[model samples]
Target chain A: MEKELKKIEKVISNLELNSQAQIQELLKNFLKTHLKKSKIDNFIGDYPTFIEPVYLNVNVKIGDDVLLGPNVYIGKNTEIKNYVEISNSIIFDNALIGENVKLNNCIIGKNTLLNCENINIDNCVLVGNVKTKEDVYRIMYKFK
Target chain B: MSEKRKQEIQRIKELESINLARDEIRDLVIDTKKEVEKDNDLLAAQINDELNKRGIKSIDIVGAIGAGKTAILEKITEKLSKKYRILVICGDITTRVDADRIEKHNAETVQINTGRECALNAYHINQVIKNKDLFDFDLIFVENVGNLICPSDFKLGTDKRITVVSITEGEWVIEKHPMLFKMSDIAVINKIDLLERLGTNIDKMIKDACGFNPDIKVITTSAKTGENIDTLIEALEL
Candidate 1:
């Protein structure tokens, strides 16, 4: 687990980390390294919490047990699944959020998905039409 | 006289006639604008006197679309509605979105749909005052149509005129719309939360505004964050 974390850190340090694509790559690697330690099960049954007021820029469907943090803006037609945590981020239109996901300080672009369970993301912006966990892995592998 | 000499004279006469006509048209345009301004000023003075007699304070808020003009008004309304009986006259090209928003805060609202008009002129406010019994209201806020150019040209008979400019519109916004800043009593630099993220120098913008209108009062605020909203109310003395 330490070796995997070191590799993820090395990947993040090597990339030109200004753009959203690089941030997404970093988040994916971080999540993959953490997932290997079987932390996914520990995040289950955690109730969603909102630390600050959530601004709904458009009609957004937020399922039960979703935790929205301060200064979070959810665009129209976005669906946040159950037991998801989002904070200080902007989720654009038509994006799908799978259950048991954690997002912090990230921007989720239109029509994207964070379908992976028990993932924690911070200071990242996921762009393009990211649909599945395999897609995230593929992008992260390219960065590596 | 010779035929060639007569032709030259005729040409000169026609050129002189065209110049005279052009000068007359220019003078007519200038005179017409002056007359309109004079009439507007007269009406504005009348409205001001009327409001003063009734012990009502009035202010006109002007800014570009998405410059947080409505949001600033909403914030002001939320804060002032508890103490003052306020009337908000929202000027829009079509919808009553702003008026409806202010009404939600328990303020009396009147929507003036100025279709194809860029600003609310003195006549519009005059008509509304004539139609409504405004004696009960302590304050009146006339939200001009969302345009920086035309709204500055027309005085809506308010005691104070405020122009809201947001940092998200970029640093050159103040320099681009100097006329609005020159005519306004106060200039509000809004959306300060995006100042660092947008890499905008709020001080520079304030300096440019002062250069445009040295007497203009400048305030920085973020309506979304409810920052400096109380200071704005205090500046307005409402």
Candidate 2:
């Protein structure tokens, strides 16, 4: 029984580390390909908001004064409100991103309504009905 | 194995269990969304039957905030009131300001205050008209809550659905909101008088609208200047 338990631990640890590395690699390549095809148009508003250094799906409605990219992917029908800065993130479709939020290295899930303001999310996978103003952080290393 | 090693195995086993449960939860969510859509469709068909029986033609107008949905409706009411008994139903987050504005143009107005709800669903419309005599009007205009995303998912039991956007919203508005264009019967590009000053390419917007929806009718109008309002009326057949 003890030998079997040790083997299981070794297998689980290896699987966790390998999956994390593989996901990071896949997401990086995906964002790189999509960013090359993204078109940055001048968002003509009072504040003059433009998504610089980001890859955006054409169906995203972005508000004024939002800073996006270097490595970001926003999917279709996602509405980003004013004064939000996001970098190195993947926001899925139908997400209602509220105002004054900052995100870095985050993977926001589909149909998630993020109503938080002025909160910084880093190195997290916020998924499935995450509607709160509290600062949330879930490091990816926990899977190991 | 050591004490810590045993705990690690147990934790991995639990994590696998949680992952399986998460997949089930995701499936449940998808099923619920489809169920809601099916219910909305059934309700919309019922409402359409009711409206048809009463000889009332309904239109649901959807757009982003400040996209001139109200301006187009105001112009529509002004022109068609002399010929038809029009009823304008305005859906707002928390104000009757649009209802008041449309009422001035000789249309009976009803205000639906959908507090914090992004979209006006068919169930709300069914309840709104259930108490009223819908036969008194020949046409009904429903201005859905000002949003580009949520309103696209709803069906308001209307004969025609219009998605309105203005040049000031940006030249990419049409491409940025593909779902609304795909579902709408008519796409109105308003505020064209300011097109040159804003330097927006109206052609690109029209092309994008047509690309998403080949069957959709695209009309460029300046509601402020009343340009192409007559053409829009003709398209609406009002």
Candidate 3:
């Protein structure tokens, strides 16, 4: 397993990573080669609708009126605000999915803050870890 | 003061001294060439010869601001470091921000703060190679000062040249900047992951790029999502 992980890292290190779709594909390929089936165990939040098979790592907070996925993976300590929709997407660690944001076929990067409202993002990769609040807000709004 | 802090201060002082020495060399070069014709072709040939003699392959990564030039360099350095020794020369107006980012991936970097100069020239490369030992590295990635205009006019004598244009810059970029594409060996149409959101016709962009230079290889990539990076590596033959 350690050797496999190292091999995966080596492959990832060689590629320019900017899109979540690419990472998703890489992981899927890795899983296909190694493990037969992958499983996710987590508690879903109240009144937050799930399309089923939604994966959440530990400490992921989902808010009311939020719609999660048929294929969604939220990483550790990420907070999802009200009226947000996410499907077929991967949100990395320490991310804040702002209110009224709709995401599909995308990947939200680590330490990213989505501070905007009423924006629809699809087929995009938001490479977070922005230095300032202004930058975070700026990018969140740029997708529209 | 803390030991770490003292060491950092000393490191900064050494950097300042090195920068000063480089500046003196640049000034000397400029003064010596004042009487001579400003022949870029001659200088480019000289740089090419120097690089060839050292058996080093050089790539010039040219792009506008926010076109993911630094991000691409970071990935390239990370991926290729094990196989080959890599040095990234980051050219910027006044900041080492790009160099600092690349160095975090454990890549050797040299920052050329080209104040008042929009493009990196052969003279800068000549001085850099003269100051540093080129035999140490197998590959050199020169991140040209961010802009599509000025860099087209200047040749840095690299083996391969890649021009990165993002979707955020719009479809007209390739049409507007034809000369850069004409001179480039590869044209990277970056930020394809934003195709849906930006409503950009990536096909037309690719077509336009290929139209400008029939031989220029066009690769669509997203630096944020890590899309088509392997293909790009293959395209570069790295």
Candidate 4:
């Protein structure tokens, strides 16, 4: 029985040392290597917010505080500002994210993000492609 | 060397081979997991938000030229626009003619004549939504520039996509313009009242619609006479 245990240990040790699979090897190395917690802050700014503490993952970076939905997917290296609310979509990084916006199936810009509120995206990609001097607004008008 | 020793050595070598392969597979799974994690996280966030505030949803309506989309929009908005918060946008190469007609329905409308159609993306749709305050509206409707080609390649960021087809065009529409039907999430047979006069077979049309999306919901309607328009409304409302 002792010999069998030794054999099993040997198999595990062998697996630990192998690196044939690229991602596995990367993950293995990540596991085996030392890791330091990133200093970058990713959090919802607290102050008169509807709900506190937008659910976050290890990879995302948030500003002071942002209102977030349950399925908001923040990609690696994303930097979200305070007072931003995102729901149901992938938000990529350094994204100058705006406040009070809802998104879905939308890929924000590599460098493009909006600061305007009351925006919603569906199955689309917005690069903040062009710089504008005017702030976009959606207002209600009374029929005369 | 003894046979036993030789056999043990061979077993070790076999184990080493397995270890190599296992490591490789493990790495692949880890990479895949990152993507899946992102997807899962996004889905999780959406669910959390949707549950909390009821939900903010948008719908996209697409069709080919002369599909009578504007006519149908007239019927839809007249009956249900006020009941549901509705935001409307019209697309044409260089004109807001359709938007003018649709605007008569009393929905806040945006006329997006980009001159070029290639730029239609999630980003563009997002802009329109924001500009139109579409999210604030109960139902946001986007009327594509009457072309099935360029629009299909880009996602307009709507929750559901309904493709419109008219019977006056012909029964061969499904067989010829399969891509248009194939790309949309739902297939709508517009101008169905013209079936008998135009020799358009409703069953064959249904079959053709199914060829692209077997589960596709088809409604035969005539805005002219208000036939089966109720079913169309039910499909959209549901």
Compare the candidates by DockQ and give the number of the best one.
Answer: 4
Better of 1 and 2 by lDDT: 2
As for candidate 3, its interface RMSD to one decimal place is 24.5
Among these predicted structures, which one has the highest TM-score?
2
lDDT of 1 at B223: 98
Better of 2 and 3 by TM-score: 2
Q: Which stretches of candidate 4 lie over 4 Å from their true place?
A: A1-144, B1-54, B132-135
Worst 10 residues of 3 chain A by lDDT: A31-40
- Model 2 lDDT tens row, A41-103: 422223312222355555777776565654667766788888787766777767777888887
Which docking band does candidate 1 fall into?
A: incorrect
Report the TM-score measured on chain A for model 3. Answer: 0.66
Evaluated at residue B25, the lDDT of candidate 3 is: 93
TM-score of each: 0.56, 0.57, 0.53, 0.48
Interface RMSD of each candidate, angstroms, one decimal: 19.4, 17.1, 24.5, 16.1
| Reference-based lDDT, residue B156, model 2 | 86
* Residues B68-125 of candidate 3: C-alpha lDDT, one tens digit per residue: 9998888777778888888888887755689789988777776665545788787667
Model 3 ranges with Cα > 4 A deviation: A1-144, B1-38
Local accuracy of candidate 2 as per-residue lDDT tens digits, B123-201? 6677557635676899999999999999988898999999999989888989988999999989999999997789998
Worst lDDT run of 10 residues, candidate 3 chain B, spans B32-41
Model 3 TM-score relative to the real fold = 0.53
Instruction: Name the candidate, 1 or 4, with the larger lDDT value.
Output: 1
What's the residue-level lDDT of A66 in candidate 2? 66
- What does fnat come to for each candidate? 0.00, 0.00, 0.00, 0.00
lDDT of 1 by residue, A45-70 (tens): 23333322244544566666565543
Predictions in order: lDDT: 0.74, 0.75, 0.75, 0.56
Task: Estimate how well candidate 2 is docked, as a DockQ score.
Answer: 0.01
State the lDDT at A1 in candidate 1: 32
